[model samples]
Target: MIIVGEEWEELAAALSQADAPQRVYVVGATNSGKTTLCRYLADETATHTRTAYVDCDTGQSRIGPPTTEGMVVHSRPPDPPGRAYLRFVGSTSPGGHFLQTLTGAKRLVEKAAELSAGATIIDSPGLVFGGVGVEFQFQMIDLLRPTQIVALQHGRELERLLANFARHPEVAVRRIPVSPAAVARTVTERRRYREERFTAYFADGLSQEIPLRGLGLQGRVPDLKDPHGVERRLVSFNDPENFALALGIVEEIHPRRRALTVFAPPFDPAAVASVRFGSLYLDLDADPGSMESSRP
Candidate 1:
């Protein structure tokens, strides 16, 4: 069960006030109660306005699987963890793919707004430790321009970010204590979580081939000079409008035939317009090895 102190009630009442927020951005360090608080607010906020929750944490996501920033629009409170409109970030980490992380978030937030959502709650990743994390979040706050920022802090650890927002009076900031129930996961557990999601996502995955003549390729191009590492890397297939359709694992790349074989979900081949590859490679069917070594 998720439990919080007086800070939780205060934030809830503030949000449920007469003028409901159009956008709320939740920020916190690792193992903080960011996701739990978001879940509660997504339900409570829906009492006042049509609600939408944007899952931006690629490592531990509730709206969609990992490696994607997803949106869930709801008329009432969200339940059973509904289906999400997702945009693949190509990688799980934000430092390497800062553009992808923020771009996907900006696009999905706009998409949710287009659906007539009155309130969009964004749940962010727990990466507020170093210089890269600080800069990345600073840019995200600038991009989202949220009506309020509900920051969960273990103590004074997130004081820098809160102080940064204090300089901008337009952005209201609410600081709260993290719930004791929030669990801190180890690195191995994180990888295992991704593996479980990948297995479930590709449960019925089939190996298919798409001719590379017209479909534009993106992300790291397998190092054309090396070409040694190609198999098992995740690739995102997007439509003409840049909406992600499905994720596939590279099986083989045929330079001669200008095509690539991939084991992925059964999406309409004709709809495939662009391909984006992820930096990390995976062998989901095999044993768990060091994921860092798998990246080239």
Candidate 2:
């Protein structure tokens, strides 16, 4: 049911001949088949050895819910991919949370390396234009130090950005046309997709109260003086090491009691050492809203 163009086939063949432990960073605009290409490459590379698929596209995430970078290690062919590691970025789009996005991607990529994956394929978000987008891509490429970059663009849309890395001897860049099968999605559809993902993630969630006394907070911390400001805000319950254990939706903030009521899937509250707040607010029964921007 997936379409693989000749260019992708050639790229795969070329990669097969290269050295082991390949770090491939894939970039493309929205609906340009970035995920599809990463999936195909992971499957192809897994046949030889363990392959890691790093999902940096937080908006349209594949391994975990939106606003989190996730990684899956494929040990063999036909491996049913699951979230092996997750890092919270706090926003669906990487616009305002550039540092979080870059940091999460780096951590996940490092995790993939730690697993000794033969090939690590990173799928980046489709924010390849504008000042922020260009800078983000540049920072990510410099930080991750990918062995190769597969740029899928319509015409010369990415030429300006790719120009910066053209002479980088350490990284090889490949430009390919967007797949013919790629379909552009409307804003409404993208929002709906995110809503569906959030809804499914919390389908069986139960309300639990978390004490804020010893909990470290990250990202956009809510105003404790105004309890309603944190209502329905998306958040992540992180382990001691700061890795996300599970996501939660703030149902209520008990400022006086120094506790938070969150609706999240079953998770050990004791394991949560910190609470990372996101800019997005979701009611589950209604469309999500962003405190950072109008996105999603």
TM-score of each predicted structure versus truth: 0.91, 0.93
Which ten contiguous residues of candidate 2 have the minimum total lDDT? 287-296
What's the count of clashing pairs in each model shown? Answer: 0, 0
CA deviation > 4 Å runs, candidate 2:
78-83, 287-296
Candidate 1 residue lDDT tens string, 1-296: 76757877777666667364468899988778788888887787777777789989987766566677889887763444334688888777786888989888899889888887778889988888777777778888889888888888878877776677886867888877777778887888877888788778888899999777788888877753345678888888888856678888888888777788999989898888988887767676577644323463
- lDDT for every model? 0.79, 0.85
- Give per-residue lDDT, candidate 2, residue 191: 73
Candidate 2 C-alpha lDDT tens digits along 204-287: 999999898988989898788687667778899998868899999888888798898999999998898999999877677653
Model 1: residues >4 Å from true position, as ranges? 18-21, 77-83, 223-227, 289-293
lDDT score of model 1? 0.79
Model 2: which residue pairs collide?
A: none
* Alpha-carbon RMSD, each predicted model: 2.4, 2.4
Instruction: Supply the global lDDT for candidate 2.
Output: 0.85
Identify the leading candidate in terms of lDDT.
2
